[model samples]
Target: MNAELFLAPFLTGLGLAILLPLLGCYLRLRDEWLAALAYSHVAAAGALLALVGGLPPALGGIAAAGLAGAGKRLFARRLSGGASYALLLLGGWAVAVLLAANQPMAERLGHALFDGQLYFAGDAALWQVALGVPLALLLLRAMSRHLLLAHTYPDFFRIRGLRSWPTQTGFDLLAALVLALATMSLGVMGAFALVFVPTWLAFRRAARWRAGLLGALGIGVLAYVVAFGLALWLDQPFGPVLAGLLVLVGLLVA
Candidate 1:
């Protein structure tokens, strides 16, 4: 058994649970529900490079995520939010499928990239999440107010002697980086759980914008504990097990 197994899982789970919901706060308000999923698909496509070319998939994820973020900013100018996100999501999935098809390790890569190999993730992944999570939190904290104004009131923000585009772009970059790091640790599918469930739950319950943030944080932590324990007891795949827990949480919240 890997000596760091317990630490690795805990850190990845905790780091993602905290950071992603914070990003989700902005994403939901900004109406970018599909943006995270699109970037994760890009990460999935990039991770497939690990099987075919033996490349560091994280680089692929970083590149793809950056590009998707850029695409959103650029395309949002002309297209509706739903349309632009639809294009990006379709394009990203196409890339993922193409990459998966080119690889011989299709099933293995599929499982590992799409669902995750979090249980088997080692020290490098743990360190990646450890560093990236705090950096993302700090970056978002610094930019959160600016982000709110820019996305929600672009003209007002710009009129206040602020160029909102630059700030929005900065958010896209930070969000992309966070998603890339998360995809590496949790797999693309699992990222959906970490990013959306807590935010949705928080927003649904809270009266004030920030009221349920802490509650969402608590829910995130509990979700991980429950899912992790259940997976262990059931001897099941951890990623799918967590995904199921998220869906159940979503239902219970509803």
Candidate 2:
């Protein structure tokens, strides 16, 4: 695969994994409406990227978007706190299984499910990164204020006549749609781990949002660079190498 395809995903993953949670953490603390809105934007971006880039990268993007939607619909609207997150978690597992069963989409889906040399197969990978990065950056900038509001005062937003339930409902639906499209590309693991791990680390270790973002980005870049070298050194598949790097970083820091 060309450098862009291999490099871009890693870079994009760094931005996304940390950004989503930071947004979530902020939203959880404040305006649920805005949080839901930011979440919606993420889903839209995923779908757009999936369509523009291809199938494999899209899968992961779409799945990440789907998680937000599932969270709002099946969990957030009816439950609170841990219960909502748990339900969404379960739904994610189920979605993954279903996605796996589609034989026609196996090659594309495999990239999401396993850590093999999935996306590292062609020149198309470069386009995947090129398309995803700008989209991610746009999402971050566009939703910045809204995300801040949503994470900091969710209940306050409801009280102020925001009609959070419907907003969340719409948010979930949009996210799911986007995720469906994105799943065609980067797959699930790339989508989920990239979005979660780095963000989690930044939150646990960094003192500020900027610090966390930088840290996560660094981790993402490092993980990919190391994975690339290791893959070459050991003559292993690229996907697993990248996946392993992510896991190793999490373990070392955790």
Score every model by TM-score: 0.91, 0.59
Which portions of model 2 show Cα errors greater than 4 Å?
1-75, 79-112, 121-125, 155-186
Instruction: List lDDT for all candidates, in order.
Output: 0.75, 0.49
lDDT by residue (tens digit), candidate 1, 1-254: 44355677777777887887778777788788677887787767766655467667677677778777766777776877477666766776787787667666744666676776677677777788888888878887787788778877888987899866556777877777788777777777677787788888888879976776676677777887888778767877777888889999899776
User: Model 2, 1-254: lDDT tens per residue?
Assistant: 45664554454343433334443333333323233333333433343344344544445445666666655555444676445544444554544444445434543444343443434434454454456545645555555554445556867766776555434454344434433332333343444444455656766888876676677666655665666567767877665666667788789989
**Which candidate wins on lDDT?**
1
State residue 158's C-alpha deviation in candidate 1, in Å: 1.3
Name the runs in model 1 displaced over 4 angstroms: 1-3
